[model samples]
Target: MSLALVLDLFGTFFFAVSGSLLAARRQFDIVGSLFLGSVAGLGGGVIRDLVLGQVPSAFDRPVYLIPPLAAALVVFFLLGSVERFRRLLLVFDAGGLALFCITGTVKALEAGMNPAASALLGVTTAVGGGLLRDVVANREPQLFNRRDLYAVPAMLGAGLVTVLWHAGMFGTAAALGVAAVVFGLRVLSLHYGWHIPRAAGTWHGSRRE
Candidate 1:
């Protein structure tokens, strides 16, 4: 398999794990966990592929379905052990975000998209899955959370990928380096409570009857 395929699969697994953990925490049934895991693993890629006018890999390729199922089973069976690690879901999410940004940009570039557009799509791919997972689980999306640094890190990683591709310096090592940097930035943001500034003052509307 190609390095790009490997990266895509790894991202899928990471995101699926995060989704599965969330489902476990929510006390979802195994079927529900699997469903959420699949959505989280494949949603972004599906969106990306659709935007590119291609069939979604999760449907076109059977291999793409394995990661989410495996993740669901793992989380369901290992709930206790997995729960011992604090913020484990966020860690996995960071890993997925880092890799998807790179792969998404690369795919868009390969499809003849301009660097600017490709970078934007990369950010979309990085965040789409988590956003869907949150909505499906009936939780607020981290992307819209004022105090979260989710999309910014994705944008940074996507921009870097675009730059490297334009410079003709994109390779396995460069890809890994960019992923590592993105992951570190996300983890650090979580640890330090970093976020972009929001509009000053909260909105207060008239109280509802």
Candidate 2:
């Protein structure tokens, strides 16, 4: 497999693991965990393909389904051990975000998308599956909330890849390097509680005596 394809597979596996663990934490049954894991693994790629006017890449290959299913099975058996695996979940999720961000930006640029569009597509590809998983599990989507620095890191990663490609560095080495930078940034942000600032506002009410 090519380097890009390998990174995609790794990202898919980690996304699936994150989704499965979320379902297990919610006390969902095995079927639910499998379903969520599959969605979280493939949903973003499906959306990315649709937007790019192509058939979903995951459907074209069996490897796509295998990894998520394997992840679901593993999480299902270890459902009760969730607390012990929290750190692993964070690491995998961060790695997946970085991998998908780079891959998605590369694919978008390959399709002749503009830099801004490519970055947006990359962010969507990094977080779309997790958003869907959260919605399905009846929780607020993490990307939309201000709790974490999730989407910003992906955007930075995508932007970096785009900049590198524009600078004539569109190769496997460049992609991996960009992904590593994104991964490190994301992990550090999580460790240090780094986040984008939000708009400040105050609410006031008047009462009549």
Candidate 3:
């Protein structure tokens, strides 16, 4: 019923869809799709909750389970149609990234975490699921991809949420605004091939190898 819960559910759905899409692309069966979807939807929150010494909502609250299951079912049944949009996975991932960063930061703050720790947890919440999904799927995680700007956008969003909360300006409008900014940045990064620079010698070393 709360806005935060609504945003969390939506984020879970988006991430789950991305996971299912990846599974479909890789020719994974329904069971695999469901597994990946659940991981991508709830893994981040689980990590965060564990770190905070709390039970993960995904397990404690049954409502948190619906989105991943729904997403897996939808993608499993409509793989053909969904495959036409090659970028849908990235788009949904971006949506999840945006929403999770905000909600994660808010929750951390609510749990009495400092601003710095909360922002870091927010970044974790945004990218943890995708990282696990990719690792389990035997693919490269975007967090380490040189040409992909994944964690930067998440950090920005989380930092903004932290700043706004500190300023006592965080609310529905601010949360939505922050999410929009993060989502737009993520999409643009995907579109324009924006990326954070690697270590000074890493690229050159790879070239020599």
Q: Who wins the lDDT comparison? A: 3
Candidate 1 CA-lDDT value: 0.92
User: Weakest 10 consecutive residues, lDDT, candidate 3?
Assistant: 200-209
Please give, for residues 45-143, the per-residue lDDT of candidate 2 as tens digits. Answer: 888889999889899988888879999988877767665855666676787788888878888998999999998999899988888888998988877
Please give, for residues 17-104, the per-residue lDDT of candidate 3 as tens digits. 9999999989999999989999999999999899899999999999999999999999978877768887999999999999999989
> After superposition, which runs of candidate 2 have C-alpha atoms over 4 Å from their true positions?
78-82, 201-209
Tens-digit lDDT string for candidate 1 (1-209): 99899999999999999999889889999999999998899999999999999999999999999999999989988888879999999999999999999999999999999999999999999999999999999989978887679999899999999999999999999999999999999999999999886655335543332
- The candidate 1 region of ten consecutive residues with least summed lDDT is 200-209
Error of 3 at 109 (Å): 0.2
Cα displacement (Å) at residue 87, model 1: 0.6
| Candidate 1: residue 176 Cα off by (Å) | 0.3
What is the TM-score of candidate 2? 0.89
Better of 1 and 3 by lDDT: 3
Q: All predictions: root-mean-square deviation over Cα?
A: 2.9, 3.6, 1.6
Candidate achieving higher TM-score, 1 or 2: 1
Q: Against the hidden true structure, what lDDT does model 3 obtain?
A: 0.93
**Per-candidate TM vs. native?**
0.95, 0.89, 0.96
